[model samples]
Target chain A: MRKGIPNDPGRRDRLRAVALEFIAERGLRRFTVRGVAERAGVSPGSITYYFTDTDELIMSAFELLTEHAEPNFNVRLRAAGTRDEAIEVLIDYVIDPDDASQQEVRAVRELYSLGSRDPKAAALVRDRLEANARTALMLHFTEPCAHALDALIEGLWTQRSWNDEPLDPGMVRTAIHGLVTAFDSLEGTSA
Target chain B: MRKGIPNDPGRRDRLRAVALEFIAERGLRRFTVRGVAERAGVSPGSITYYFTDTDELIMSAFELLTEHAEPNFNVRLRAAGTRDEAIEVLIDYVIDPDDASQQEVRAVRELYSLGSRDPKAAALVRDRLEANARTALMLHFTEPCAHALDALIEGLWTQRSWNDEPLDPGMVRTAIHGLVTAFDSLEGTSA
Candidate 1:
């Protein structure tokens, strides 16, 4: 077997990173393969060589953002001493104004807009979101509570997207506490 | 005061309805003031005479759609046999495929995408959403529970926008049930 090109993986990752930044800055409506290539100091053909089209580049960039965030989020959740701490970590990550990943929030919103018309994009987003929800649920709660918790977390994220005011951390914590208690009581009954 | 212009109000309503249909079919990306005027069977100058710009047209169409849906929703909710019945009515309205007003759902999602970059659109969506939330809370639950329920309902609508599989009516009922029960429990504790 021929050895893989030594720097090929690095180049591919660099291209995706640049594309993500472009998506964040200009939005998917304005994102172009040539733009990404130019910003990455690469040829336009290289983008085409790596990604089938702009849609693929965008979908890949979205997948990469989630993949990057997942491990860190899981670690934070696992390390939290209390449910309140876990909820706080989630809210802080979600609503932080300084984070570059916040741009992904807007990007995902744009993707959803496109997805309404494009079935392929819709499928890509739906599949990834369901997978993310399932993974998050499995990580955080038992089977009985996982579905409801997923719904609650998803609701929180959606609210953050639309609400102009910064979320009150205390209110979020109170909701989380209520959810946890509700789930615990639910578990006792089902058991 | 000048006597009301006969047919003037009817002409404006017809123009707004046509604008809604055109925008829904072609999307805001391809929408043009001239195109809307042509479809509405009015002169381009007439369109401009009524609305200053494309943004004004879009904002007006959105307002028209919201106003049309609001009263019907309120009437249905008020007529429900019980609180549970009201929740069911709300859920059915939100997820109903047969409802023509569902186009409003699509329009709202588009407005959200626009809101990310356009402060005016963002403010419009936020103000309307918050006002609706406040009104619903005042009618359905105590202040705190209303706030929480508003977030939940808004989150559910956003999720519905991207979901590929048709929402199960039963699942929707479960979510509403959980939220209502949680609020009722909270209210009891406070009492």
Candidate 2:
């Protein structure tokens, strides 16, 4: 068991924020409870008190980062009234290096890596993806189509991680447009 | 240093074969070199002699599994009667479970996890992907399209990893078809 901090809500947020920054900078493999605590100007006990384990801390930190980014997505989606506009926003988000924080990208990569080997971690990612898709305005397609869209988006991110070349916004738009058109055409047909 | 097992090229093959089986049966996180050696009926020294480290062993074993399942993609491309046939083969190969071993999938998941945090490991995967694309029929596309296809494939694989449903052959085929059609259209426009 670890000792508790003063239990300020701000303190917990600050700690998690610092942790997220560290994860993005150092990569998740190198993140440690002690290191996060030190950076946050808190005791190690405070970290353990807020999060029971390393995985818990990592997961929470990830959740925080993603949740923070989610609003931006929502703002974009809401601003786009048509399907094409929505896709354009999505493609822009995906390929625009300036739109994404390096830390956030690194954190997502870490989550993906952890998810591959751990069922619980994988479930976390799956749940988030499903939840995001459900909330997404792009859920106008059938169940299979929606799921396939998810696959395409996830696949795009995986590919993005490996390459150093700047992703072309136009190519992304074309790919998403192609996918949407294909699914729309296949609506009545058995998938 | 680890001792070599003499008089048998089969020994190395057997060890890798068994290693793949073990990985499929048990996730890579739980797999060990000793366990692979034992399953192969070889000594630990033999496993070490062939693979200096677990990462090397895992990577090589995966490379072997991929080669074993699919015809040399590059060779197929060169011998292809038409560009369509080559693209079809590539599509068929990606989604065809018959040609892809469970071990190969596991190895990929493992590599993805490592690549998330390790730049060097990520570079290897990126290089492999670029090499595969270079050797394929996509050289005709503008450099951006060629790279976009790589991202699309990577995203597809990553999505497949997190998906809860069993692999759908038809869906895979549809995705490949869609991708090819989109690329073909790009060619038409460019021409």
Candidate 3:
């Protein structure tokens, strides 16, 4: 195992980390093995050996990004003692990510646009969405509610990323609270 | 006015129209002045003559694309006689964009990602969002609902673009209805 190159866990992680950093600093149009290798203190040959090509490298970095995000979500969910608290957690997760994580949103979006054109990357993003929906399902959401909330979350970030309007404070919480309470009443009637 | 080269109205419109077509077929990375000019049967200098550079051309293409979408939204809004019909219109607008417009979605997304990096492009998108929100306000939605719906629309597209799970037929309608009904009840209580 040549450290930070091949057959080493640390090398793989480092490569992924640096790849994301480069994407964050620059857009995906310029993501290059040589650029990452130069920044990461690894040889370009090593990055190729491990990643094969730019698509592989982009996918792997994205995988690392999603993996990094899963724990925060788990923590947010665990912190919710009630359904409303859980809704708050979900909204914040979508719109109010920490500074470092905020950067990831832009990076991931670039990857997503890439995915729309590239099936391999699309598969990676799609797998994550499925797993996330399943996780929401496990948390007692009805199927439609699960999909709606997921899409709503996606929409909030999508708006924030490209929109000019400053999202009002408490807006999401109001919308989400309204959504869950409606469903709660529906559950009441059905039950 | 040198027909296809500057000081001419037709030249600008033609350039914007062709730029969008190329973005849909090839995405933004390969969207170039040369390519667009070649496709339009004009010299590259003509493109530069009409638009200052690539960023200006891209931002202009985005402007033309959004302008094209606004009328459909207005028509959809006008067609809906009831709140439910309006909600349905909103859902369809987000998810079931038609063939030419489907390309616009991809094209807009690329422009959006481009906005995050380029201030000039970002300014263009932001201006459109402000105008859109203003129009929604004139339609009489409360502030929260308007932003939430916008975000939901954005989220639906985001999920469709990246999520692995296929969206259910009525999933968006259900979610939008749920949120709207919740707020309606809230309004009922307050009134």
Candidate 4:
């Protein structure tokens, strides 16, 4: 079992915040305990004391981001009156992303890649993506429809990060709406 | 500007092959020139001597993978004269992945993450995805339709990596056909 830090929430939060910063600025490739320590204004030993395992620390930091993101999203999703409303809610989230800084988007992408190599991290990523997939599956679309929607959501985010111009929100909505309409007509319950 | 490695293709290929192995086995997180030297059975100096920059080496290895993958993919893609046939070709590549080893999938994902933080690497990744998206766009679909299709293709691949079962080719085909059919109906030249 891993030991806890000095029982200071502030201190613990600081360490996590610093870790996220490292992940954001340098990416997973350069994220290091010493880097977190130096940025946190604490000793490297302090970070190790709080989190015995690096993966645990990484996961903890990620959960913090998720914890911050999911509530409002879930609330909005629940409040959505219709299937179309629910998808619009989802689209808004994707277009804006969870972190206003857009830090999580990059960090999450890094984690997703990290998951490929790190079984534990991969599991965490899978859990989040699967949760999203489940939500989509529950919609009127079939399994493949859900999968395609999920992929389009992720793919657009990725495309935005690379494209010279920032993605036009109207175009994104049009594209997303087109996908939903198309899928609805194909496998929708009413049709 | 990066200096060229030695004029020997064999040495350069060995370095890249070793780098690919490290990327495949450990991923880019632990990928280091020193590590490459140890795995390649060469001194650290030799690694530095051949590749002036680490990023250059990484990019070279990536380009090598691309060169190996794209030609075969393009040939198959060209052979598919019909729009439906082209999507099938796309599906096969994503489903089976380029390398049966599945190493390329993970490696490419890592490069994608790397791209978000590293401008040069991001450019390389963008170029490849853009090229792919362009090919899709040139088909029967409009720009947004093509983007959605491109996104869905990538999204399905990602979802599969996390899903417990192997991606069903039948399910994939069904989902793809649905999306295409939906789009075709929406923007049919006749309609």
| lDDT, candidate 3, A24-117, per-residue tens | 6677867788999999998998888788798788788888877775567666676667766777678777666566766877787677777768
User: What is the full ranking by lDDT, best candidate first?
Assistant: 3, 4, 1, 2
In model 3, which regions exceed 4 Å deviation? A1-6, A78-82, A162-166, A185-191, B1-6, B78-84, B162-166, B186-191
Q: Provide the lowest-lDDT 10-residue window in model 4 chain A.
A: A132-141
Evaluated at residue B141, the lDDT of candidate 1 is: 61
* Candidate 3 per-residue lDDT over residues B1-191, each given as its tens digit: 44543387777899999998887677776778999999999999978888889878877888887777556766777667776677777777766656665576677777777777888767766677545644653364655677777777776766766644445656666677776776566567779
Residues A95-190 of candidate 2: C-alpha lDDT, one tens digit per residue: 765535545666666666566667876776777744565467454555545555566666566666777776667677666766666666677564
Per-model TM-score on C-alpha atoms = 0.76, 0.73, 0.85, 0.85
Tell the DockQ for candidate 2.
0.35
Model 1 lDDT at residue A139: 65
By lDDT, the better pick of 1 and 4 is 4
Number of the top-ranking candidate, with DockQ as the measure = 3
**Residue pairs that clash (backbone atoms under 3 angstroms), model 3:** A126-B164, A155-B155
lDDT of 1 by residue, A1-191 (tens): 12342347667777888887786666665678999988998899877777788878877776665566445556676777775676676666544644444566676666666666777666756676645655655566654344445556555665666676766665555555565566666567769
Residues B52-158 of candidate 2 have per-residue lDDT tens digits of 88767766666564555324555666667775686666565556544244345555655555566667667666666445655465643445455555555555555
Report RMSD (Å) for each prediction in the order shown. Answer: 5.0, 4.8, 3.4, 3.6
- Name the candidate that leads on lDDT: 3
Best by TM-score: 3
User: If ranked by DockQ, best first, what sequence of candidates would result?
Assistant: 3, 4, 2, 1
User: Model 4 off-target regions past 4 Å?
Assistant: A1-6, A69-74, A96-101, A136-144, A168-175, A178-191, B1-6, B70-72, B97-101, B136-140, B189-191
